[model samples]
Target: MLYAVVDIETTGGHASANGITEVAINIHNENQVVESYTTLINPRQFIPAYITALTGIDNDMVAEAPYFEDVALQIYQLLNEKVFVAHNVNFDYSFLKHHLAAAGYDLNCRKLCTVRLSRKLIPGKASYSLGKLCSALNISIQNRHRAGGDADATSILFNMLLETDHEGVIAEMLKKSSKEQVLPPHLDRASILRLPNQPGVYYFKDNKGKIVYVGKAKNLKKRVISHFTGNKPNKQRQDFLRTIYNVDYVVCGTELMALILEANEIKRLWPENNRAMKRYEHKYDLYVFEDQNGYLRLAIDKHKTNNKSLQSFNSLLEGYNFLNQLIEKYQLCAKLCYLQKTATKCTAHDNGQCFGVCSGIETVAVYNKRLNNALAELQRLQPSFALVDDGREAEELSCLVVENGTFYGMGYFKDKTYLADGLAPIKNDLSIYQSNSYILNLILNHAAEFPQKLYKL
Candidate 1:
């Protein structure tokens, strides 16, 4: 296999916005370097001080050098039909892909990451940075940050991996990549490559632009790639893959937000392939009702969108189990909770577990008071509240708004003063979603840990 061991110094982190200042490619044919190329390219933009300090490539050095557009064709021809190998292949591949696209060349090459290879072949290292790894392995690097020097060092390291690859892990990785290479033909590589590695919700749309599936991911890029690569591709998964023409994602502030948004979007879109999430949409609801004899009773029932529920469960069995706990904790009547069917009295009352609300032995007024207390215990401590959490970035804060025991929506704010007034001024910022038992449970589950501050609205 011809491996193009590549490296590049960029103007910035973003592939679309940034330009490559210097790049190098060392073509290896398993045994030795067969061909090599390196150049300083004028990025057409001023390199930041921090970047120049690291890469040692200043504007003056690249001022008269060929622009990326000028060298795009040559680079494309050299790298095409070769495994695009690099330390962190994505960084180099994304940069090259973006620039090549702009230069009217569609460059699609198979990739092999040396960092990943080293992690598998040479385990238990303190650091994995190219310089650190090379130093630890005693692979000398002359020009630490220069693209050509780094590329040559990486090529040497890649050769070491080739020698040390005893378990055929590299071969397995290539096979996996080969499968992914064809699974979703219409899904563009650029879109998948650009997916941010963060918590988010993603939508898979068909050729007609209809969402066929909705999913949540803690790491958007990793999760989405696993979808296309990791699974064994069962009939259902294969069918799902066939229908997917594109994917779009929304980055969330936290995992909790991503989960909530996923549930909401699944309910809203009712995506055909999202059976798992759809099943949880309205599974079971805990409801409080007044019986014919004017006693407040609690029951677990199949969820309906119109039903006002205290909380939700993914299954009827789960709802029953939770209700059983509440009944025992509060000495609530089994008959009242639909756990007993006897008309005269409940087994709980007979066993002294219940307060005899099922029979005349306990006064109705006293029994009803205890029932109300139990219900109150189940209600949120703060009826209308906002959960303030870390937003997508450091300067912003995420707000999960709940108004009068119902979740309104979620939004982010930079100003602390806006939070003081309670979700009114930032209402425009919030993307409203319908309140559901699942999301209510999401809030309760997250609030259990007390990870975020709660403010009464």
Candidate 2:
């Protein structure tokens, strides 16, 4: 393939925050240079003193030089339909693309990077800076930072790199270039590119722009990528993936932010695809009654009372199961537990299990004391408390709790100073909150140096 060896000097590092200073494009064909263009650009701003010292192209030299728009098309035609090669492809390409877009053009060119190729072909080189590589390989560089000179030096360097392993190197580079699909169907790579590699929540929105799934990720990009890639996912996974057409995410200073955001989103969107994070019906306060003889009867009852239960259970079966296990562990009698017959001197006392609590042999006060002791042991979790953890970003923290008639996973703030920031209730779909199951594991899982603290309301 023909090569357009291009080098550009910019006013500053950021693509959006700066303008181009000088640009040079040298087009080369098989073993010969075909065409080349070089010019200082009127950046319309004072060049930094350091930049002037480096490039030696002061404001005076480019004073009358045409702005980027005047020469864009000329260079476009010259390098048109040719391979866009550069040292650091993203930096150069991003600058060019931004400048071109501002000048009323959108050029999406296929780019190849010599830096990556050098890393693979010539392995274990400490620094891959263009000047460093050229010096190491005995290539002469006339002008250090001038665009024309750098482009010329790059032209020579490209020849040397090609000669190093002509066929083998090109083949590998092409394979890698192929892996980068400029734009995939129904998604913008920008969706995942800038996502911070910290714990946070992400939303999968459908074509109608409605959220379909709410998910929390320790690494948002990687988790989203997993859904898009991989060999056929399971049935449920496939359904979740199908509903997702685009992704929107927030960067939390910490996992705590992600957890809270996820809870809020799920509660709000009520997305069709999310099976988790959505709310579920848990058994409310359990029943503890006393028999005619004052024997404590532990009963599994769901009265829909507002008082927090001993423990939340997903189903009545689970509640029953846990209660039965607790009964067995404490050596409590089924008769006193209200599990079997409605006898007075409970059947368990008759069966030699109950310590005659149903009869006068065991004092009412003593038996009830023992039963209360067991109940206290079983109800270890706080009725209502905030679980404080790290926030999604630096200087941030999280507060998770169930209070004032709601279950909130996490709330965010810019810094710890706002730890007591007033929380606006997060209304999330019951399913969205359920998707945060892993967070429970994360918070409870790590308790060594940083233990998750719980503060009661």
Candidate 3:
């Protein structure tokens, strides 16, 4: 029940080199185009020899023809409330949009393409260009490539392709091609439909005005739509899309730029679905909890705000258990470290295994000295350092670092607008963990030409 099977003759090849010369629409319903129209307009310039030879409409033929504005109304009436079916919908639709934009009339319509549908429905066609498609599909064109004739062919081919089955292919391609993926109802299609597939950060927000999820991708729109298609998904991604009333995006020039932008925005908005920031891993684990009895109890608590601990573990039990095994191996004290504080003779001493203070078996001074030796086994996460990385450029990535905070990381800046002089200015970021890790590792690897220089912030 669609209206227009449309085609247009353009001035030339590249859209930037052209203007629409002839317009035609064949209106059809129930698989029949009941009405048809066509017009040639003065393109306000000389028609090239190739175009003249192709369409058989020359410069002299349209030298005195009506201008586009003269016939815009008729074109609108014919195309209004109609599905715009064309060979390559993008070319035709883009040309049409440009024409309408210049003439102060907005042309927005649902678009369907014969090419995509033909690929899906009819299998063996070597080509889908209007000329070849007609020959391949056994449909004949009277004037070949002329505006009205091409449209008539597309209309016939649209019906014939549908005859081959794959019942919903037309509708599905029509829905996807007519607009960008999953747009908010109020926002117009062309707004994001024209977004270049460059690297960028994208944001999704809810009706009550809170950011639900933030992400970055080398292909912005493609990545954003993955949440909707449920291809490879998570529950958080699903829930966010369900509640997303709007989408907002920024186009970064490169992947490195996208990386920084994503980190910055996630920290700023603190989206509910972002899980990387809140999770923190342990740095140091093996430590002594000095009890009030002047006895050292080897526990697995990470060193506090003061001194660094030996290592990190998932739980205190694992730490003490590991230390206990080491204790038995070293034949050390159960009582001197207060492990059996009430024993008259230490558990280890009773078994002739104690090197402990129980029963005056060992001195605290020597025990404390050996305890420092076990502390050497742990690796400590650095407190304050600038983790330099690649910045976004032809031979670059970027740098991110934390100064005096747990959550802060830095951004990139340039001394000059040209950015050809030296290194950019440093901007620290806060509350970004995944990006910090990504910067600390992934982005830095991209800058392999130079070694990373760790500096105290």
Candidate 4:
């Protein structure tokens, strides 16, 4: 089989925004390199100082060199119908594919990553970077960071992998079903293979085993594999893929439980790649306190971690709207609830809805009693129920419990009789998780759609 072991030095890390400064290709016919090609191309852009420092390729050096378009046809011809090999195959493949397409050439070929091969064949190497791996293998590199030098080094490494692969590991990886071509270079096929096709929260960990991203999926294997399916030549996507070394997951009974677990894990881990959930915060909260006059007062204020809120809202308007409903329903004094700023009696009192508490005609005890009733009603309205759903196993049952307006937690139980007993036994068995507005919304939406699954406590 013919293999085009290729390498390129670029202006930056990503392909879309970056320009290729140089490229090198070595054609190998299984046993040895048959032909070689290398060139410096005018990237048509300014190479960053750090790039120039690393690669020794600057604007002045490539001033009169041919642009990528001038050599696109030659590169395409050399790579066509060959197994495209590279240290990290996708990086070089993406760059060439993008530039070639722009140059009006369609370059399509199978891919082989020497890094993945080394991880399998060489095994137990501390590092697999081009320079380090070459050094460890005693393969000499000429130009170091330059495209031609790295390509030559990679060619020699590929030859060694082919020679050492007695078990036909390379052939196995070349198969369409292997998924080695699309997977992150640092991540192994086994990690993905071991993932259950169940609903769950998956964690993507880096080389040091630090959690970098958290995600929920109804089909864990399908969702996790989807991340590596596309060749998105963006900095964020490329960087995210490069860091993933392992995938770990927790199987849940239902998608709703998976969603809840995902949010909680993201908040707890504070993963670097988790953007939206990390920034999520309940903007407003309903709070109740006693004034010096022994009157109970309610207020909607910005959420504070130190204070416990009766209810949380995503916006101030939502908080006010809910408070308004409580005012109309419980005959609460709008002024006492901080819905009005006027020094005179509140509009509710003028309309005969408020019981003259603002004007001091109503006794504090009576007004306080009414406010307490409203608070009790609000707690009652907060649904305390258990969502019973299909478990990970047929013999087991999954239960998500919310009691007294707060999410208690979730767990799997073998006994179906937990449904008949009170929430106390279920709570004792379940694992407790922090509740957020996002999780509550998901649960409420699920309940609305499938009310039969909901068992009120």
Candidate 5:
């Protein structure tokens, strides 16, 4: 395969924001350079003084030069279907892809990094900078920071790597390029391509068909592609990719539905990568219980599944802190709520914050009435409502159902009759998910952020 050794000077570090000022590409056949192209293009934006000082290519110099738009098509044609070779390949490749995308050319090419190759083939180098590496190898560079000089030096270094490569590392790297799907050995590209470009949840299955990971995305195809193409320098990611042998997905009509499905699936499947959810240990809970006199009392107790807590907290401190605020705001007896222990009237009653229910000075009927109101307010934390938002299409809307302060499910409804008449069809199409602390937090935050979209049904 032919290699296009490339180097480009940019206005800034970010590919999406920066403009290309100069570029050089040297075509090689794993032996010697056959053809070379270098040009200074007008970026059409003011170049920073530091960049000008570094590259020696000021705006005045490029004023008469051709703009990137003039040469974009030609450069794209040259690099098409060729292996992209560069020192830090991502920088050059990303810049080209961004600029070419703006120019309406979808440029996709396999990449070969000289720096990664050097690390494997020529290890133990003190510094891997292009200038330092070239200097150590006695390769002469005419212009230190110019695109042409850097590209030529890189091409020579690449040829040396090709000649010394005995273990087929270079071949393996080219095969793992991001231009195409980087799937596991047992998985096929056709499976990934079949994923829809819509809001959905996707599953990564191992070789034995056991789900290893579950994730949600605004676009299933893009998110799945990002997982395989990411340059994660960790063993966990490598292990995950290696074990993924099959792909599965469920399409959601909206982003909100995707999130709910993701949380539910992670909790249900208990996927290997989703251990964080499994490790969630509920330590404390805000509980409501009845005393011997039929008086309703609230306490922050140690959480238990059988207790069926009204609200759960990850820590005792959090539960107590929240209880303290409720005692102060609702003028409730701290002794009754377990915030203060007392034989007679509580300290809140002496402070005129409580109605003296602990000492029977106030009738249970009057005191219980206020306590029930406070409990009802706290119960409203998770509202019983249906949030209707924009769906994947103009004719539909996504409905998120929370029945009696519990997450029922989510679904898409196309007929307007559901909003005006009945919800039988919408209820039948709902995708149910487990109601846990994580899911509760998500629903609460979204409802608060977009209250106008919520319909309290």
Candidate 6:
């Protein structure tokens, strides 16, 4: 089989918004390069200073050269029916595919990343970057960042890989069922292969072992694989994929558990790629405090991390509605609760349920007594329960405990008799996690859908 060992110098990292400045292809027959092609193209855009600095191919160098459209057919003819090979194969393949299609040519072929091949065949290299790997292997790259130099260097590395691949690693990777081409070049296949086919939270880590992204999945293996399936060609997606060198995961007992854990992990780790969850915060909250007059006043206000809240709500309207219900049920004064702003008596006082607290007719002691009773009732109303569900292993059970309207934590337990002992014993065995309104809602919704799993404490 023949391979088109390819490389390109681009105006930027991603394809959709960037332009290819130069390209080189060396046709290889497994043993050696039989043919070679290289060209500088006018990309119709200003090349950035950094790109010029790295490649030494400035705008002036390509001003009189042909545009990609003028040479698209020639490039296509050279690549068609040949295995496309490159240092980081997806980067080159995606750029060429996007440009070729825009030029009215459909370029499609099997892809092989020399980075992946080197990791498999060569092994134990400190770095897989073309310059670094080539230098480490004592292969001299004449022009460094130039397309011809990189492509020729890559072709030589490919030949070395072919020679060393006595175990047929290349053949196995080239199979239709292999995930080799779909994965990021920096990541090992074994990292993906070891992922469990269970509900979990997965983390994407960079080469330096820093977590860049965190995601939740009902099936860890399936969802992790899905990220590498498509060639998105966007800057964020391309950068995200390229940085991933490792994956870590935590197995959960249920999808709801996975969702909760994902939110908590995203908040804790604050991964750069986790945009949506990082911005999530409970908007409003129900609060109670004592005024100078010794009246225990209740109000719904914006959430504050420093102050303790009676209950959290996603919106002001939700908090107001909940407060209104508490006022009616507990006969609390609307004026004292911040629902009535007028100098006159509150609506609840007009209805004779507020006990004239707004007008000083009710004594502070009497009002405070009733307010204390209302607070006690609120505490009584807060649901304390445990969700007992399937565990990671068959012989165990997963338990999530909610104590007085707050999520306590979750864990797997082997003892079935823990249910008979109640939430205390179960909480002892479970691992603690931070709770938020989003997580509580998930658990509440799941409990509503599957009441059989709900164990009220």
| Higher-TM-score candidate of 2 and 5 | 5
Superposed Cα deviation of residue 144, candidate 6 (Å) = 1.9
Candidates 4 and 6 compared: the better one by TM-score is: 4
Question: lDDT-based ranking, best first?
Answer: 6, 4, 1, 5, 2, 3
Candidate 2 residue-wise lDDT, 1-457, digit = tens = 6878889998776566677899988887746568888988998888898888888988898899999999888867766677777776556666777778777776665565676656655767666788998787787888888888888888887776777775585554455333322222234445766666777788878768988888888888777666654323134543454345578887765665566566667777888877655654444335787677667778777635454345555567777787778666776766666566665776657666677765668788887888888987765543444556676555665565554323545555454334343333322311124322244434544333354465445
Candidate 1, residues 256-333: lDDT per residue as tens digits?
A: 899899988888888998888777666788998887888888899988888788877888889999999989998988
Q: Write the per-residue lDDT of candidate 4 for residues 13-127, one digit (tens) a residue.
A: 8999999999999999999999999999999999999999999999999999999999999999999999999999989998999999999988778889999999999999989
TM-score of each model, in listed order: 0.52, 0.46, 0.45, 0.96, 0.57, 0.95
Question: Where is the poorest 10-residue window by lDDT in model 4?
Answer: 415-424
Model 6, C-alpha of 173: deviation from truth (Å): 1.1
Most TM-score-accurate candidate? 4
Cα lDDT tens digits, model 3, 44-138, are 87788998888988888888778888888777777767877777665566566666656777777776667656655775777667789789768
What local distance difference test score does each model get?
Answer: 0.82, 0.66, 0.62, 0.91, 0.81, 0.92
RMSD of each: 20.3, 20.0, 20.8, 1.7, 13.1, 1.8
Tell me the lDDT of model 6 at 271. Answer: 96
- Tens-digit per-residue lDDT, 154-265, candidate 6: 9888989999999999999988688899899999999998999999999999988999999999999999999998777789989998889999999998888899889988
The residue pairs found clashing in candidate 1 are none
Steric clashes per prediction:
0, 27, 21, 0, 0, 0
Worst 10 residues of 5 by lDDT: 177-186
**TM-score order of candidates, best first?**
4, 6, 5, 1, 2, 3
Candidate 2: 10-residue stretch with minimal lDDT: 427-436
Per-residue error for 343 in candidate 6, Å, reads 2.9
- lDDT over C-alpha atoms for residue 256 of model 3: 60
